[model samples]
Target: EINEIIRHLNNSAPGSDNLSSFFFKDTIDYVASIITHLTNESSRTGQFPDILKEGKIIQLPEISNAINFSELRPITILTVLEKILEEFVYKQLIDYLDEKNSH
Candidate 1:
């Protein structure tokens, strides 16, 4: 899990939280345990923190190549913590699917 987070930190862009993966990656060793704890708490409670989900929507009309505002591509910049949660949830889903497939 830490490895996956680290991978994203190095390759992904900073989110609205203004916390870049590089920041966490460089300090992964120090924060990995804390993140793991938070991850577990979030799962056991079956609730994601409201703060983590607070992200900014970046609209890119030029990139979307559309004149209509609705046609613009919207990107979500999640907090670093939220990004980690997203990865953790993704892994859980993948594992569940793989387990079911093996049945």
Candidate 2:
């Protein structure tokens, strides 16, 4: 699951952990188990590590010359771990919905 999720991730900016998508894809063979464990633990415990919840919010201007607050979009950059965990839960939710709808 981790490998499948990581394969589709974009090379976006890193969060507070400073870990990028490339880092995960490159080191997946060596780190997949550790990440999987963390993600599973988080799911079992119903609580995520503080770092996983942390994100860096940056405001990007909609136009080259932005002057108003509405012109700026706030983007939150979360860690690769967070992204993986999210994908896991998302896939589960989608599967559950699919199964429910099938019956």
Candidate 3:
């Protein structure tokens, strides 16, 4: 998913001399960092409770407001989905590890 973003950014920019490349790279890095943080937090806590409390989806206005759809011309929804998948896998791996350790 990150690769696809980079590919698209590179294709769209068509030159390394532009600042857009840096922006795209930074955005990808930021997304990766967020995914890692969320995964680690969820793993330690056993679930994403802040995101879902009492079976209700929590509305994170800060995050929602930060993501400007109008300015997200090159960003695809798949990027968010991929990050979610990564977080889920990380949590599952951590759970498996904990279970093995307990046994």
Write down the TM-score of every candidate: 0.80, 0.89, 0.31
Q: Model 2 segments beyond 4 Å from truth?
A: none
Off by over 4 Å in 1: 63-71
Candidates' C-alpha lDDT: 0.78, 0.86, 0.48
Ranking of all candidate structures by their lDDT, best first: 2, 1, 3
List, residue by residue over 6-88, the lDDT tens digit for candidate 2. 87888988888898999999988977888788778877898878767788899999998999999999999888778888998
Top model number, TM-score: 2
Task: Please state every model's RMSD to the true fold in angstroms.
Answer: 2.4, 1.4, 13.2
lDDT (Cα, tens digit) per residue for candidate 3, span 1-103: 3344343443232222233444545577566566557557876887764323212122333444446545333422223333344546766679889999999
Model 2 weakest 10-residue run by lDDT: 46-55
Weakest ten-residue segment in model 3 by summed lDDT: 51-60
Q: TM-score of the candidate numbered 3?
A: 0.31
Clashing pairs for predicted structure model 1, backbone only:
9-21
